[model samples]
Target: MRILGIDPGLNTTGYGVLEINDRKLRLVEAGIIRSKPSGTLSERIQEIYDGVTEAIDSLKPEVLALEKLYAHYDRPTTAILMGHARGVICLAAAEHGIEVEDYAATQVKKTLTGNGRAPKTQMQLAIQHELNLANLPEPADVADALAIAFCHYCVWRGQRVANQSADP
Candidate 1:
């Protein structure tokens, strides 16, 4: 199964495409979708929509695992801004006919590092070790995206196997 993971933001959204084949994980692609603060919010969203659409087209992932929208009481605007980016990401996924699942940041972190409050460096290292990458996925967001995908794998692996067995 191919899964696309997304960590959405208005300025810099991160993406990771992972494939589960024969019980192994492979990183097909990982990158960032950047929008400069100088651009209008509308333009940034459009750029995000375009970049994500391209990824969906090129990778053709079976489903998408997206981090759920989160906000701190002190910083409400962050959630509002991210809502725009998430909208476009989901829009692109819908257009491509891919199913979407939303996971909380804590859930993803716990799945990856066994701690809901694991640090960013730990998440990066975990992803690096999981994918056997020579270098850590950069800029934190990229690693976070990969973690989201890995979380889905951990949550669904057994169900997927059972379903496959039932099919035959």
Candidate 2:
């Protein structure tokens, strides 16, 4: 299974694609989509939509694992903008007919690090160790995106195998 993980933001939305083969996850691609703050909100959304569409086209992931909206009391503007970015990302995934699952930040971190309150560095290190990467993915967001994909793999694969067993 190929999965695309998204970390949505108006200024710099992060995305990573990974393929799961026989329970092993391999990183295919990872990057960030940046938008100008000076642009109109609608324009920023369009940019996000376009970037995500391109990612979908390139990666052709079977599923999309997205980070759910978590309220940030210190940054109301960021939260609102991230909501818009998330909409664009979800819309693109839906248009491509990929299954979408949202995971809370805590859930993702816990899945990756064995602790919900794990720090970013710990999560990044865990991802690097799991994926067997020579170096951690840069800019933090990419690592977060990869962590999201790994989290989905851990959570969703169990359910998938259960369904298959019940089927035959």
Candidate 3:
């Protein structure tokens, strides 16, 4: 199975791809999709859509795991703009027939670090240890994307085990 995790943003959308073979997870790719900082809203959206579509085409992930939208009362506009990025991402996944799963930031953190409020540094370390990487996953966005992907793996593994146990 291959899973693609995304941390969406207007200026810099991050994505990570993980491939599982015989229950071992491997990092296939991880990077960010950058829209021009000065581009118009529609132009930026188009850029993000194109970039993610290209990734899906090249990487061929089976599923997309996306960070769920979170809106703060003080910064509702941030969430609204993020919704645009996420919308295009989902559209790309749907166009390619890839299932999309949403995971909350807290849930991802808790699953990876055993703490719902784990700090960014801690999360980075957890991902590094899990993947046995030589260095920390740089540029927090990439680390975040990887964390989301691993969280889905953990959840999926648990469900698979439960199903097998229930099988007659």
Candidate of highest lDDT: 3
Measured by TM-score, the strongest candidate is: 3
Q: Candidate 3 lDDT, tens digit per residue, 33-102?
A: 9999899999999999999999999999999999887787899998899899999999999999999999
* lDDT (C-alpha) at residue 45 in model 1: 95
Task: Kindly indicate the candidate among 1 and 3 with the higher lDDT.
Answer: 3
Per-residue CA lDDT of model 2 for 4-102, tens digit only, reads 998887788889999988867799999998888899999999998999999999889999998877889999887887888888788998899989998
Q: Rate the local accuracy (lDDT) of all candidates.
A: 0.91, 0.89, 0.94
lDDT of 1 by residue, 1-168 (tens): 899999888888899999989988899999999888899999999999999999899988999999886776898888788888899898999888899998999999998889999999999999999999999999898998899999988878968778889995
For model 2, the superposed segments whose C-alpha errors exceed 4 Å read: 164-168
Models 1 onward score TM values of: 0.94, 0.91, 0.98
Stretches of candidate 3 exceeding 4 Å from the true structure = none
User: How many clashing pairs does model 3 include?
Assistant: 0
CA RMSD, predictions in order: 1.8, 1.7, 0.7
Ten residues in sequence with the least summed lDDT for candidate 3: 66-75
State residue 37's C-alpha deviation in candidate 2, in Å.
2.9
